[model samples]
Target: MIWNIYLIILTYFLLGGIGFYLINRKKDPLVARKSYTKFIVYFFIVNGLFFSITIEPVVFRYLAMVITGVGMVELIRLFKISGYSRKSFFATSVVIFILLALGFCFFATLNKNLILFTFLVLSIFDAFSQITGQLWGKKKILPHISPNKTLGGLVGGACVALASALLLRKLLGVSPVSLLFLSAGIILFAFLGDVAASYYKRKYEVKNFNDLIPGHGGFLDRFDSLIAGGAWVALYSQLADI
Candidate 1:
């Protein structure tokens, strides 16, 4: 456990810290940099809370409920403020909220290590995508939805995310077969999640979700991939019977 803690810290600093800096430090006003920095802080805060509350299972559920509550409120506000009022959309929101909130809490309660490690893997994918896209991306995959996303970045992110799954296989305690599944999950779903968020942003013409997280836009902005990825992971775990 102690050594694993060290490993987690080292991985966060090496991959997340250096990777974020390399990818985001060239901005003119440094908004990206500030956002990346706050992401680090937010990461710690969330994981700290997760680990600390592991002793009481209900605490995790409570936190999940609180998050869902906030999300519900945010969705309502978004619809109202954005001048969108549809009963079916609101119903869809309720369904999504239930699935996400309960599913995430179930994972955290089931295996802290798995869930936390999954997050790190997502970060690795995101960092590489951002870095590779900015540095060498040429062919835009779908410039309409997300201008910055490129073919190179998507390929690079997937490859690196798969590589990371291999490297952290023992830490995550999965076999070669399971590794393949999760690698695909992290890459495919994470990309979809991010792009989905980007599409919503484009549709709404909103720069940042809420500016609640300093440089990271809103809580939803920061957790977009995690939200999508978590639901997928939970479903996969159940379906695979693993």
Candidate 2:
């Protein structure tokens, strides 16, 4: 299992690196640099996630809590920086934090294989979406909300993600029908989660939630899809009794 994961990560990084390099080679040096930085940051995030899930369950639980706590802090800071009154959102913020924390904790408790499968799908979707969008994306899906999101990117990402999911069907030891549903759920929710986060950023008029991450906006920005996608998976697991 461990070897499979290691191979997956290595292969993904190699493929992603080639795509990024090809796409960014002709761009402005600064823009290309930023894109590479984002890739490196994503690499670390994936590794961190792998570590969290592979560690002791008790420790993973606490790590999830800590990451969620930081995300909440970042959320609050975003509001404050945007000139929003904290008191107005105090109650709502608290509830969101609680739910997010619980979501992460829930993720920590999921089967390791399931967790890896989820991450792998998201990674494929995210990488291919951005790469394809930048390369060939012509139709903007939500120009007002997120100009970078394109129909081309969406289709490309979903296709690649779904293909990867189908290829790795053995990861979850589930029926083909179940795997299909799970992949669709992850892709749909992950995309929605990203759009939802973008909606807030548009409202906030902030480029990023914070500058904690070099290329990725912040903790919340980086993990928004994971939180939402994981929540969907958790709910699906219960409903499907997986």
Candidate 3:
């Protein structure tokens, strides 16, 4: 079990390195350095969270709380940087959203399989989205929000996620139909989550979340997709258990 996870982590980084290198090959040297640095930080954080949630599932709740607190701080900082007063509606809405995500994280801890499912999709879907998008994307998906986002990337990401699920069906011990449905959910929710995060950043005129992870913006920036996707995954996992 542990070795399987280690391999997943290794695969994530290997693909990530290739994708980032490909995308940033022509960009400034600073970009590549930052990408590699943030990759290292991301590697450790992901490993830490995975071990806690899998080996010691009980710790997931506490870690979820930590994630929540960190996100709140990062959001506050982002608001300040935007030089805007905190709107009550925006604050309330976001607080509710974040809390809802935490609820999913807590619930997922009850089953190791569910927990693994959440993280695996997040990792695979995200990396391929960028890699495929850069290589074949031509039309923008959400040009108004994130100019970099492309329809081709979205399709590519979803396809890769679904294909990856074929292999996961064995480990998850589910029928192909069920796994495909789950993959579809991951693709939809994860992309929406990422878009939601991008929306906020664009609204605030902030480049990244908070620069917590060097190349990757702030903590919220990295976990934005997880926050949203977790909410959706929680429902799916619950239904799967039924």
lDDT of 1: 0.68
**Alpha-carbon deviation at 151 in model 1, angstroms:** 2.2
Candidate 1 lDDT tens digits, 67-154: 5566556556666776785657556756765676667666655566566557667767876777677667899988898888999888
Which of 1 and 2 is the better model by TM-score? 2
Please provide the root mean square deviation of candidate 3 (C-alpha atoms, Å).
2.5
lDDT (Cα, tens digit) per residue for candidate 2, span 49-144: 777666555566676677677877877777777666545555575576567567656976888778778878988898888888887899999999
Candidate of highest TM-score: 2
Quote model 2's TM-score.
0.91
Candidate 3 stretches with Cα past 4 Å from truth are 80-89
Which run of 10 residues does model 1 get worst, by summed lDDT? 48-57
Give the top-scoring candidate (lDDT): 2
| Error at 3, model 2, angstroms | 1.2
Better of 2 and 3 by lDDT: 2
Residue 230 CA displacement from its true place in model 2, Å: 0.6
Best-to-worst lDDT order: 2, 3, 1
Overall lDDT per candidate, in order of appearance: 0.68, 0.81, 0.74
- Who is ahead in lDDT, 1 or 2? 2
Q: For model 2, which pairs clash?
A: none
Ranking by TM-score: 2, 3, 1
